[model samples]
Target: MDDLTAPTGREEALRAMPHPDGTAPRALVLGATGYLGGRLVPRLLGGGYSVRVLARDAQRVAAFDWGSRVDVVEGDATDEAAMGEAVRDVDVLYYLVHSMGAGKGFEAADRAAATTVAAAAAAASVGRIVYLGGLHPDGVPLSPHLRSRVEVGRILLDSGVPTLVLQAGVVIGSGSASFEMVRHLTEVLPYMPAPKWVRNRIQPIAVRDVLHYLLGAARVSADISQAVDIGGPDVLRYGQMMNGYALEAGLRQRAIAALPVLTPRLASHWVNLVTPIPRRVAMPLVESLQNECIVKDSAIDALIPPPEGGRTPYRTAVGLALRRAEVDEIETSWQDADVLGVPSDPLPNDPEWAGQVVFTDVRTAHTSASQESLWRVIQGIGGERGWYSNPLLWAIRGWMDKLVGGVGLRRGRRHRDRLLVGDAVDFWRVEAIEPGSLLRLRAEMRVPGKAWLELRARPDADGSRYDQRAVFFPLGLAGRLYWLAVLPFHGFIFAGMARSITAAAEAADAQAGTG
Candidate 1:
């Protein structure tokens, strides 16, 4: 992913679409915390538009690097007072939110949110409303998910305010849910048994091109208030999409068996078992896949020119998506912005995981090792250095993770010496890092619930103190049972890990003194 704060040399060009008062037009993004909205906000800022975001959690928005750059109005869209005030001073509003994972009455929830935005935008006299909706066939009976999207688009257009709705199919990118789905399913299944929807044809768009068109839409005429389709050059069947990912990942082609009896519900459960996607999110996505979605015309080009050379082809997009994994760096992931009980949150030394049953195993060791040596060992915990514990157990765990389509331990670190907050270390994602003090790693392996490992080093009277803790939050009965199953291995894995790490630090410090 391109740096969100970098200037694209087109800031001055946006001056042509200036506000009525001769200022840089301010754009208010409704779903600023979402995947598409999070990406769009920084580009809007880079393109010379003053941006504001409506966020339910202001602190979450503030955590982003570009958070301080944009104005934040903390509120939900369904709240009438908040929506009215949020749209008041904005010239353009981007509606990138929908009720995808909301269980029952999701259609009602989406309709209500869209209705609120339409009314608020019209009442505030916002310049233009831009929305991103799914691309579906014309006269077919749409699924509840696709039907709700179409209804939301109609709500925006019927409002007195001019709206431009960009309809796109499966978006292909490093962190995109669709791309992740394709990647995991292809990697895990050599011989696939899929639902009949795997044969459906769809036009997948690259995330960069999606951003390009969204940025260009800001400059389009207010008269263009209709929904336009945007997508990549080549259209392929869903099975072909999976094979495309397999090709980019340098894996052999998969043999697919499309079974007619497998329903969307069953397919979602299968997806949950294989990929990181939760069943709720997968259900709607699977249902929508039943339709064949493709660009019917070249209408988007007349308003917004093709991205530089042209739109990315399907295979090329897959390659771009795979490049991040190859380098062990995914800027954002579907997990970061997906369904419930996501394990991305920090450990509960405080109240981060309050009211939940948190199981923990704590270990401490005092060693005749310099603080610097201890810090180095803690920082280099994963990757090629290994976990400083039983090799067979670690290997077995990694193999199990790979079998279930998890990232596994093969995705080493970005650097051998240094560490960053977002860097990937084997099957763990670096959650927090304090120089010479602390490192917290969140588990990315497929588990029933959330898990984290924390390591800390501090200066003692003569040497150093090393502290290690393993924390887990159970989801349900299954999550609790999983914790019990692994509890016995704590002696072999966690305790030995702590003792080995301290011993290694002592050895390193002794060697340094001799040198």
Candidate 2:
């Protein structure tokens, strides 16, 4: 049994691990931009492993706080040549890539991706492969999503590489797909008319506990090549899990009635109507609830000791997730992935004039405050702190968006004071951010047209020049009419907003100077 943690010294670990050049035990994370992968890189770094991340868009991954710490390789997992380059000089490969949210044929895509990465790891002679997979009970029929996870795990194990697969049920955490589904359902509905599958039992695991197991796997001996089942201390039905969340969220007890006629397809539609999660991601998740996912085997307990405080109870996990959401401290969100209909690149500067119409309201102001102070005020715009202009108008608009199945203002910003490229701020996603210079946001509200708001600040002799612009590309007559209707309000909102932001920045600067 080769000791996974024998080389405790950072310098010694580099030499001991199989690396082309002598460095630390290099760990290459394939899906570093995803929810779990985003959190895992920082932990691996803390555990003394040199980390490198591979992403399709390096700029997207670069927005993460830990991005600067790890070496980033820009490439897609499906590309063999890119995988070969990424796999080289790596001791452990964390295969966290999946395509469940990628619409149809994702199962085939997932299988192909797993095979490609497994072959790459074997070719690179990687010492170990660590994978996080979904839990499915044996002898029970698995959903397409769960089956794909199982197949991927099998592919890695059979690749002649020592693979440690950790199979977990619904991961309870802020921004996790499973937890968000639970959070939205519990928060929005007082009486849930759910499918009969709500009765199915599940063993949910806290994200913290799951991260612990992932990190622990890296320290285990290479002799351990089997799959491990991980779960929280509580085994509960899906409905009961929702009840637990409700209690932790301080919401009144929700009444859930299971309807046999309500199929998974129908339930997914219902989820889409009530939650921010789209139907494509919701359908596969709803389908998987039909099968019981409680952990049957607990063999991993001996291999990796539980965290110091022990496994998180289901209720405790829900509370922690809710707290993180309340404080807007979420590290990663399922929304961090690409939204299907939104533009992948930044909004175009010039409008398409092929019989298309765009309305723009651009305003500029000169503020006698530093660029840093203005940016600080601009970045803190959306959450509990109201938008600087008209609080009542913003509230009314959010309520209307919520009525139309939009995220509204409740999703809030990830952090109160800081703005990240992918962070959700109210109903707008932070599309781009240039520190102390510019911030652009794309509207997620249910609208008849595409819209954006851009803010720019630059240092000037007096202080700084602040500019704000609102751009809308109307789809048709309805979009044009909608813009016309909102034009008067924009004049009021945009003007007042500029004045308010400048005032706030100057006040803060005055207080700082006096103090």
Q: What is the clash tally of candidate 2?
A: 1
lDDT digits (tens) for residues 371-489 of candidate 2? 88998898888878778889888888887876655666766666778877777787898888998889999888879988999988889878888899998888789999999888879
Candidate 1 C-alpha lDDT tens digits along 153-196: 99999998988999999998876779878988999999999999
lDDT minimum window of 10 residues, candidate 1 = 3-12
TM per candidate comes to 0.79, 0.82
Residue 379 in model 2: lDDT: 82
lDDT of each: 0.82, 0.81
Q: Model 2 misses residue 274 by how many Å?
A: 3.9
In model 2, state the lDDT of residue 407. Answer: 62
Candidate 2 error regions (>4 Å)? 1-23, 220-224, 250-252, 323-328, 339-343, 347-360, 368-370, 386-409, 442-451, 460-463, 471-496, 503-515
